[model samples]
Target: MLLKRLIVCLDVRSKRVTKGIKFKGNVDVGDPVEMAERYCNDGADEIVFYDITASAEKRPIDIEMVAAAARRVFVPFTVGGGLRNVVDMRHALLAGADKVSLNSLAVEQPDILHAGALAFGRQCIVLGMDARRVGKSLHFPSGYEVVTHGGRCPTGLDAVEWGRRAEALGAGEICLNAIDTDGMRTGYELEITRKIADAVGIPVIASGGAGTVEHIADAFSTATADAALIASMVHSGEYTCSGIKKELAEKYHLPVRLTSN
Candidate 1:
């Protein structure tokens, strides 16, 4: 069986890792490169870095920081935020990113998903979809609206529809984040997570609102996600990747990758 993945997400701003609730009021947590190295050794199946302010600032992600992480950590890591085109994605991959994620830019120019996947292969391209619970509308029957610019802009696109489109465009994975539950530590937004997961064949990584190990277990079971993206829980030092995997394996009897630990 393919073991379920536990991913640690580091939202970066000004070269430092930051945490925020609903993508607002962010505070510096640590150095991005340093934190990534710690998580790599501490048993994160994969690590994801988001240049949290890059899209809002209209600048590309910090390639220097990505290179620094590449040198320090020996694990598969993904880099996202403000990637404008294929050239930008190439730069990140050359700098040692196992994968490059696209969010706002992908929604704005979906062809980039096709282009990135064509140039780097589908496995190298990930779509990080940040969505909000806007209730159901005629346009968004799924009750989840796709939001961009770190949840500042509502695109009027249904989350599940976008997931299906991204998959058809050659995206290898979808990192579905629920803006409403982000940093709340309540639990993952399973409804949207499952909807997107079911709507697409590509692997779905359930993100946002992971407070307890039980929440993580719920993601793999009820949500049927291939991976769980953790932030506040591990970012606050309240949990470790190894510890979470242990709990998921032993207590929940979930198929987690404990071998790496």
Candidate 2:
């Protein structure tokens, strides 16, 4: 069995790690570089840094911050937000991000996905999808629409169809974040997660609404997700990455990398 991964996400705005509910009322949490190092030490498998305002502000990502976090962590790190083209992707990688996640830009110009994959290899390209449940329509048969600009804009694209297209365009992985459940910590939107996971061959990382250990296990087993992206639970100092991994191994019988007790 493949070992399920536990990834910690740091949503940065104005260079500080922040957390919000449904992408609104965001408040600064701490320094992102310090938080990344803390999570890495807590045994997180990977770290995802999203410059939450970069795309909306129409500016470049904080490459210096990415480099600072990369210097502090030993594990793989993914960076996203404000990355528009192949040149931006290359700069992110050069600044120490193992992968570059594309969302709004990918939706606007899909060919960038093909270009980035060809230029940097598919493994370095991650598709960050922010999806919200919408009423069923001809355009959105799945009733899930892709949202961008930090969940402020909605594109009529169906979430599952977008996942398929991203995979076809050479995205090595997809991070599916549910707008409704973000920071709520109730659980993942299993339906949409499973839908995208089943529709795409690449690994799907379920994001948003991971409140408890059970929720994490459900994402892996019920949703069939390859990884879980956590923010509030870890960011609020309520749970540790090692603790979650232990629960998954002992209670859920899920394959996870356990640390020495």
Give candidate 1 misplaced runs (Cα > 4 Å).
259-261
How close to the true structure is residue 104 of candidate 1, measured as C-alpha lDDT?
A: 84
TM-score of 2: 0.97
lDDT of 2 by residue, 1-261 (tens): 668999999999999999999989998899999999888888899999999888778899999998887789889999998897888888999988999999888999998889999998999999999999997889998899999876779888999999999999989999999999998999999999999989988999999999999999999999999999999998888899999998899999999988774
The TM-score values for the models, in the order shown, are 0.97, 0.97
lDDT by candidate, in order shown: 0.92, 0.92
Q: What is the TM-score of candidate 1?
A: 0.97
Q: Clashing residue pairs in candidate 1, if any?
A: none
Q: Give one digit per residue, the lDDT tens place, for model 1 in 1-261.
A: 898999999999888899999888998899988888888788888999999778778888899999999999888999998689999999999999999999888999999999999999999999999999988989998999999877889998999999999999999999999999999999999999999988898999999999999999999999999999998898898898889989999999999877564
Residue 18: error of model 1 in Å?
Answer: 0.6
